[model samples]
Target: MTPLPIAAPLTIAIDGPAAAGKGTLAKRLAAHYGLPYLDTGLLYRAVGRLADEQGVDLDDAEAAGAVARALDAGAIDEAALRGREAGELASRVAAHPPVRAALEAFQRAFAADPRGAVLDGRDIGTVICPGARVKIFVTASAEVRARRRTDELAAKGRTVEYERILAEVRERDARDAGRAAAPLKPAADARLLDTSELDIETAFRAACAIVDQAPH
Candidate 1:
């Protein structure tokens, strides 16, 4: 695919629930547009992992906020922050207002890149970059998302039950959507893309179309 022409700084914010394929779409869009991509959810996951490693109570806002403040976003071990555990921990820590505030600056800075950037997370469009040039809320049915997540983990040699994964996916969705701090929801102006039946290639092409049609 040819790189899209970028006449000015363009920020693309992709927000969605777990395993909704937003992360993959964001990375592809970033590459297509020659922009930097940031998986903002990893920031929260890193904080959660650090807090757990330090034996801090995950529910303690003060402790989690401190972890968030001290996090080295660039130094996060992406390999370790994958799978069900990290996702649950991230959801827990992300609900704390202080934790969200501490990490907000980093996301804002990343979105301010002069060239361009693509950020994907629960609240990228609603909170991190409300004024982003393009905002996409990519989603799929809970069952589909759970199946994808289960397959992903199994491929990594971790045996997981579909029923349990589905339940966990629903639980995470409830927690994420109910959280007082930056609850997961589509931005008012964000275009919605339901990827329940679409493959990654189709989703990427659809996302690119959204970006192309948006006012630059």
Candidate 2:
């Protein structure tokens, strides 16, 4: 892979809510900069999946925290996590303060790696990497986001009603934004990218430009 053109190693934190195109932008930025990308959402999904596997109640804060604390990145199955149920469960688990705290060290270590890294999630900038050299908050209209998600799921042969998906998206936004721990708001220093009208490539280019111009 070509190396990311950077004066020195640093973390790039991308934060946004569901279906906001933050994931796509982060992945492309990582590739362009030759950095490893971490979908921080995956960590929550791992905890939620593990908790469900062990028959723990979704609201059991202590058990959820313990599961998150012991989560091993090696155990995560990205494909399996794409399930709608898993995502909903993950969001619920992620609202737990302990669960978010438990994963902070892992995220910090990844950010401080010599090779550099890019992380994307609901709070990557607000909490996970507040000091990150480049912080991007990607966002889109609720309707547009829901439509994109519906299309993606349909392409994968996963049947889901569009209105149901839109409702879920709105519900998730509310939960994330209302959470007590590291709520889903852009960091003060972050550059907000509203991709409501832009395509993936265009949004990515805009994100990369922000990263390129940010002071290290």
Q: Could you estimate the TM-score for every candidate?
A: 0.95, 0.93
What shift in Å separates residue 92 of candidate 2 from its native position after superposition? 0.3
Tens-place lDDT digits, model 1, residues 57-119: 999999999999999887999989976799899999999999999999999999999987999
Strongest candidate by TM-score: 1
Tally clashes: model 2: 1
Off by over 4 Å in 1: 1-8
Clashing pairs in 1: none
lDDT of 2: 0.89
> What is the total number of backbone clashes in candidate 1?
0
Tens digits of lDDT, candidate 2, 30-54: 8899999999899998899889999
Per-residue lDDT of 109 in model 2:
83
RMSD of 1: 4.1
